[model samples]
Target: MTKAKRTAKKLHHIDRAMSETAAAERQSGPMRVLAAVNELSDQPPLIALSAATLAAGLVLRRPALTRGGARMLASHLLATAIKTAVKRSVDRTRPHSVDDGYDYRLEKGGSRSHHYSSFPSGHTAGAVAVARAAARTWPAHAPAAAVSATAVGAMQLPIGKHYAGDVIAGALIGYAAEAAVGAIEAAVLPAMTRRSAS
Candidate 1:
């Protein structure tokens, strides 16, 4: 084989090895717990609780959380859209689709589609976005928000929906989104307020 062909073959072997390693990791007991937690993170009741907390902060006019809630919500939504687009483009397979040899305790009532792309977890992205925004808006609450984000992220491991790398990528995306939104708000909102006051 030519030198270029040899290099290509080597790369292919590396790819296969990486896939096998990932499969093994997913079958681990701790990973299964992470997957279960990830499924719980998507529960409707938990989501509702988060929404209610945001609403309560706004209704009560808690300066720390009112603006943070609005901005975080916007950033999280934007991150979700971006994540969805990237997942579609890359089309990474979830752990459950890799093989029938691996057992998956899938959450009941969850969508049956095995094709759900798992490049970046939407739940982790949203949670991280909200946590970052909250931390920035209320420095005093940063520790709590950080803890919540970490807990939510840890839950994604065992359910076999996403790998450790997926959660980390999702978190980075969310934090970037939150920062971008915060920058825009800082730059634009004051100007709009001043213009309206004139």
Candidate 2:
């Protein structure tokens, strides 16, 4: 075969191998489980859970649950907004979509296309944000909440949704969102209390 033809044939074989590897990974039982668990972090379910917690708190007359639910919902929403902004600003292909796991494209801005918006993992951001809010309300569960958040972030890797760096950035965004919400509450709640007292 000519040099060009030989090169083409070799490239085809390499692509086939990569495709097989990717398919196998996707079919793994553990990965399937992870993918299912990741769905819990999705917006709809998270929102529903938050609303349920708040409603339960109201009905049971429990201040802690009321505060926890409010904070969880607010922080997750903030985190989602922050991640969406970041995804638009920084473009990177999802790991599963690219041949090279480490390859990423950075540009001035990104499109709304899901394929190119992978700089930060949205699922991880929301998960960590909700976890942080829960931990703040129930300080005793802080450790477990942190671990759960980390697990959610880590699961994004093997499932081919995001890279480690993406998860880390997402976690930071989550933390920032929660901190901002907490700060706002700290500043406003005391004033409201004083006003009510008067």
Q: Largest lDDT belongs to which candidate?
A: 2
lDDT of 1: 0.68
lDDT of 2 by residue, 1-113 (tens): 99998997686456434433543475479888878988998778877887888888999999999999999999989999999889989877776666444454545664777
Candidate 1's displacement at residue 41, Å, is: 3.0
Clashing pairs in 1: 31-158, 32-158, 33-158, 34-157, 34-158, 35-157, 35-158, 35-159, 36-159, 38-155
- Estimate the TM-score of every prediction: 0.69, 0.83
Off by over 4 Å in 1: 1-36, 43-50, 101-116
Model 2 TM-score, 2 decimals: 0.83
> Model 2's lDDT to the true fold?
0.82
The residue pairs in collision within model 2 are: none
